[model samples]
Target: PDPTRAESKTVKTTCPYCGVGCGVLATLTDTPTGPQVTVKGDPDHPANKGRLCSKGSALAETLSLDGRLLHPTISGAQASWESALSQVASRFKQTIEAHGPDSVAFYVSGQLLTEDYYVANKLMKGFIGSANIDTNSRLCMASSVAGHKRAFGTDTVPGQYEDLEQADLIVLVGSNLAWCHPVLYQRIAAAKSARPAMKIINIDPRRTASSDLADLHLALTPGSDVALFNHLLTTIHEMGAVDSAFVAQHVDGFDAALSAASSGEVQATGLSANELAEFTRAWIGTEKVVTIYSQGVNQSTSGSDKVNAILNCHLATGRIGRPGMGPFSVTGQPNAMGGREVGGLANMMACHLDLENAGHRATVRDFWQAPTLPEAAGLKAVDMFRAVGDGRIKALWVMCTNPVVSMPEADRVKAAIANCDFVVVSDMYGDTDTAKLADIVLPATGWGEKTGTVTNSERCISRQRPFLPAPGTARHDWDVLAEVGRRMGWQAEFAYESPAEILREYATLSGLAAQHGKDFDISALSDLTEVEYDALPPQHWPLTKERRGGRFFADGRFFTPSGRANMLPLHHRAPAKPADATHPFILNTGRIRDQWHTMSRSGLAPRLNQHMAEPYLEIHPTDATTLGLQAADLAEVSSAHGRAILRVLLSDKVKPGAVFAPMHWTSQLSSAGRIDAVVAAEVDPVSGQPESKATPVAITKLPAR
Candidate 1:
């Protein structure tokens, strides 16, 4: 403890960037100037053994206290935690009492830990008696959740990350894994190098960097994924690739699904007959295949149907729940799966239970000792903001997310939040687009200073252990939420002191859900002591006595009441707003190689910013020429919702009539690089997930200013 002496220790934790959930070993050294941190990949972790991507490797740079929110604030004035908490609690109570519980809402995030999400869900749904709680995760994977529940009778991922490497043919539909989830891409790249016979198929509207590793790149029409997959299913049937025994015993609605597949219009996919034949032949001939999709599939008007179409082929051929095959939805955030497990979505109950089910509501209410619970689903992301805009929602609390920058129709969402009666934002930074409009801004502990659990996309539960001291007066999200709950009169239910206690409670409650035949049982860890919880390693879900860790449904047994999976009969549906003469181009928005959503943490790293310094629209060279735009030229992209001025990067990576732009820039980072402001708010009818990818847009070169 000598002054000016360097002291160092390593702490094991999980990377907070993406769903790959690579483990990190952060070494914190106290120097004369301040404490410094350096991180490396953890070799023991199964997700990515000693693999750190550009974002993960640069995590230490983002942990500084330069721009962090260190204390609570009320109406832009510095205030004590007591005053802020009391104001938030009293205002919410007043609003609910005045206009009923439906008038108050909690908009959370997938970035939150499971303990934090659990407390927020309990306080809002169990005690407050409102179902108007939703997460930004509703933007990323709600379609996958809806599709999983429709097909398997539960939100279950049937395979693990190992299946990506084990499969002979890996199909990437609407996912650019090389840039988005780099660690998993590296794993697949290594596996392909080791086994040259392993083939990759990238199906997307644009040829991304991931296509470099692909044996086939299908630049199909945007929003026509259902047609492509339906054609593949038809080929599977005609080629006699169907596992008749598996279908007869384990699947329902095969005949109807096949009939729908037979009637699908493959020409809608925008691929030649030869190309379709090649794709179908490879897919149907390969016994071991994995179809992995991401935001491109989930951020569409027909997202749920697209997901079901892919699952239809897998269920028909029995290419799922095994070592080398399945339909995998790679989540965009680190804790999206964790949010799903704790019922962070508006339409879900805790532990994969149904919100609309009376039995599920009674069980959760009784377990939490709550006075009441909602009997119906609440407003999703798109509708939630609409409610706030039109005076239906009075009080709103946004936690661990920047919806103003990330949500579809973001400009309108920003306006709604600005006009809300009461708003609270719990975040590390106070100047985010969403936080700037809050009535109360609370300081929450960030990555290196918070301890809790997160579940990865493959259902692996892992620990995020604290390695640094909490900066200033910042507190953990779960701690702040529990204090609010207690302040609002639910003292006993909100009396948790640590994240360990909250996790224990949640795990025990999962036992009740499991008894109801749910697929999210983790009761084996319910009795973990403090020491045991601190030392918990990464483990897969279904962590019970009978099944500790493995893939699901390999035995042909599903979680449905009929004990069988349902293959839905699906048809091709175009985007909500197709390109017309007024807006003659399709605007596609997604992540870049070195940035995370909104760039709150990742933007702090200079090296990461050096990779892609500013936002630029990727337009095909032919289209750029037609529009009289040059590389580095400023172009105004406008939709019916809003508009943004972006620098042009002409490339044929995109089709002639389509353009691509990264969705990471915000008002603080750039003057006019907020791309989501230009996205429309159309959502899938079933899942309520916004169509972030297929916005009809018009682009023009900006005149010199």
Candidate 2:
């Protein structure tokens, strides 16, 4: 090999896995034969400061040509893009004509770029005039959105990551930050090291690795968050910690909320008075408290209520808008926040806009230049699957996510997809359980091979630039969708030459939002050329130059017409279906330290496999003893929805009536290890997020053979 003509270039990009959205520097090296790309953290990005977690670091390995969907595949054969697009459009048209707009649904994902999400949302909710489009975000942070809306009158994150460092008290509620959000955890850890007096609290049922950093750990029972938060409110009020002036000026319904919080019924939520008082006292004593929460709070049947219960305490004390004092929802995916910004969720319109308001709807319709728009909120995740299963939805298009392995009542989801008249799957890998059932498979660009932007948990937007050519015949998701749109008679709007162009248009859309008073406005980049877009640096939202480092609700002005927040009164409710005598154990599902969802990428790494390589149930030793079970004992867990078998690990981490299982593995990984198979489809009424955390089940020790 010769080194005379060697060259190199660096591309700024963002991580594609978790919501930390660490900025990446992709270096392409030119050799005598060919070019090779390598990745590392971008030092200037605020989220990570040049550091990356395992998933983001190993992203390059997963973008291989092996098992890649090379072309538009229909009925197990390769086809032209034109033919595939024509078939999809014609079929969708015929299906709508035969069964109605409700007969079809678009199931998209947070992994999609804001541009892709915007177009899909427009097509399904505007052109198609069907309120049946939803995204994988429903399974992640829909509850947080609902909670923010109820408490603040808008879906807004009021603080920046710097708040985590500046806080005197940091509370990790129902989140495993150490494992799931490693980069953010590192920041908190570094902050603690720098300021030894800063206190940390971990509030969760399981004593996870994240608890290692906690000064105090509240191992509260599952579904008891509302009570604990309510008790905190009562204590704050009694201690005179309430910001009376701020509350009076910017809030309403505090009396009813306070009355409900102080009621005796709160004690029945499995928290003792003493514990609640201690937690509340700590919160009141601290001037700056940042409470971070995730799926553990959002995956419950009363998920939205739990979110408000937490936010209510912050608002009552007027702890928001100031440094180190606010409610922070740590998102599960890298672009989950971006998805919301672009109105990717089923119930929302574009640019943090509302769907129900006639004016908001009219504005978005006019912005998109759409023919028509859906008049109401769309069907959510669970409802979309229910519609498909009931035959109300004739066709379904799923992108980026694997519902068959990840959704609640996933077996039924698989069955529904299999039975649907038409099912289209767009993915990077070809062999996922969901993709196997596709009537058509469109290969999508993976992390290092795609270019776009993703917003992290803190609302920071970072660019994702391709380091190398797309593997095999895999295409960018926006290109594929746009091609299909063109075939469907949407010519000019979908005619984009590059992701850079699409991003410029998306930025312009955000600019349009600025004229309408939405805080998510990104008008600062509306003038960027293609070269500038490709070379754009990482930045946070509310991207107008005037508001850099400014968190939301700083002026105590909410998005409601009254410009005031609402303290929604909430009542505690148990899981929709509690464990019974027949199915007597509560099953909790979650992620492990070193694995990604459904083992699509993480499973490819042998080193990543060392941590809990197999699926096993973590049951209390006492429960295992009563059930004649021991560590590594084969056991069968059965629920009303389905059944699965796994090895049992008797541990004290779980309560006697409760069990825990990691949600990453699938049926392909282990014959009987798919936990979602045994999970129920119960969902929160307000958030539409499934109750994956608490499912009733029965466990029996199986014979060794």
Candidate 3:
């Protein structure tokens, strides 16, 4: 119904889906059914100029409390908040007392807001005395984090989203930006349309929808990115694109890096020599080039090395930290960057602090007044579950993520959670794969019902303001963590009355980090009142009184201890497991245009589900013919770990020996397809992110009953 401005409320928030973090104006108005909220893109926001993708456009459909876990549950029975919080604190305390503090671990998620992540990290690492706090982001961007640290001496992204527009060339390797990050893709498409001289390169084993815009498509082998990039490094040198002055001034280990990357061939990539030569010439000739990569580059055994291989080319030519050239890792989550800022990973501390550094640890310890901080890094995601299976971790608290359907070797992950002594899950829905096995379940607020700040891929901090009322008995995830902290005896530190208070403390800690010479400093925001936080604009980071609204490394200064970036020598390494005689086809998993990871909340949206009605495996026509499989045939895909039955989708996009499947369906949503079941748990050695892209599996036609 049409109403006056005072009658209707419009609150500004950030999109909770992908890392594009587009600003949304949610207008609440009275409808016949009820007070319905309508979401529209905020034109005033810079990340996106009044543009939203299909998933973001259909967010209102997923906001209903139809399947919500409105109240806390203990052992399948509804319980009061007091009893639930006390039981959680008591069980965790018992487990830690009987075993060491490492016996209890908090496995969190990238879906969580920054405030939710900060409180969870503080409770686990500061009060509970264990570093076994890892987020689901481990499976996504951990390799990129390790690579950024190795190259920049810290985890920092040098380029902003505007770089995509200013670049003369954009190289997309192992990323399908058209579907996963459509808003950003729209921006690039608009930029290319206006310039007409801008070129795009899509490199992957399969030709996806994203390839439609590419001037050149390199359909290389599944795990051959390192070889292709190393060859690019050599090409940069051979073409005299090397910036000798910049390298000598701001980089180290040039000779060793070139020596290691000196040997590379095009044939190894399974690409024609002409194709390789064309890409190399464009990369070398373009002074303004940006290489964008995603999970496909970060989900291999050599994921870190693959990142370094890309960075090597940029660093060799000094193409980074400039207006339109650099290596950009477009993250997979809305607040994956924010999670990094709060040190949500097991190996990191808050404010981009190092977990292994004693001085940094001392700083966090002194700041939080934490008496029992772990001295070293703890188990990553895969190892954390392995420890759970082996009885090393007695109590496990999972928040906001569905690992049973999302984790590789997910059948084993489910079994491990089933065998564990105590499991607590906090989420909006109670029927998720992980929540079913949970001993205690706590209802948490959803996107439009929660208020906090989230940092996007460009280090732009935006507010996720709550415009709707919290449904039923659901509580904010951060408030739940703080109440648990109070029950566990840290009332002084976790005594935040609102998310703004937690944000203030987090910003104050960043000020402490600046004292130690860290790159992350938004301390100027520490003095924001509650009103200011509610009205917080989308501001890029490194904002301070001394230096305001500036990009990093433009003046030839780095955050490394010696003020020089390190160039690491990297070698190509094959995936941990290759396709064998029994498992002849390589199974690659990714998202479709619509559906998200495991389809927890997204599956509820009918419009989104209409895009992908069911789960199906996309196999090349040749492979389908070889296996006597036809379109609409049900096929069972199996690996050494597990099996999944899927309807067949014959496509020419994938190579002959490869098949593709969406990583959205779970047992709850579809009985025939669970992609993670067939995925191996083999992780990148440095980053511990599982190889979800290149799992070898055998496909066969499933006979009727």
TM-scores, each model vs. reference: 0.99, 0.97, 0.98
Clashing pairs in 1: none
**Which stretch of 10 consecutive residues in model 2 shows the poorest summed lDDT?**
264-273
| Root-mean-square deviation (CA) per prediction | 0.9, 1.7, 1.5
Each prediction's whole-model lDDT (CA): 0.94, 0.85, 0.90
True lDDT of residue 236, candidate 3: 84
Ranking by TM-score: 1, 3, 2
Cand. 1 Cα-lDDT: 0.94
lDDT of 2: 0.85
Off by over 4 Å in 2: 1-7, 30-37
TM-score (C-alpha, index-matched) for candidate 2: 0.97
Count of clashing residue pairs in every prediction:
0, 1, 0
In lDDT terms, which candidate is top? 1
Off-target runs (Cα >4 Å) in candidate 3 are 1-6
Which run of 10 residues does model 1 get worst, by summed lDDT? 353-362
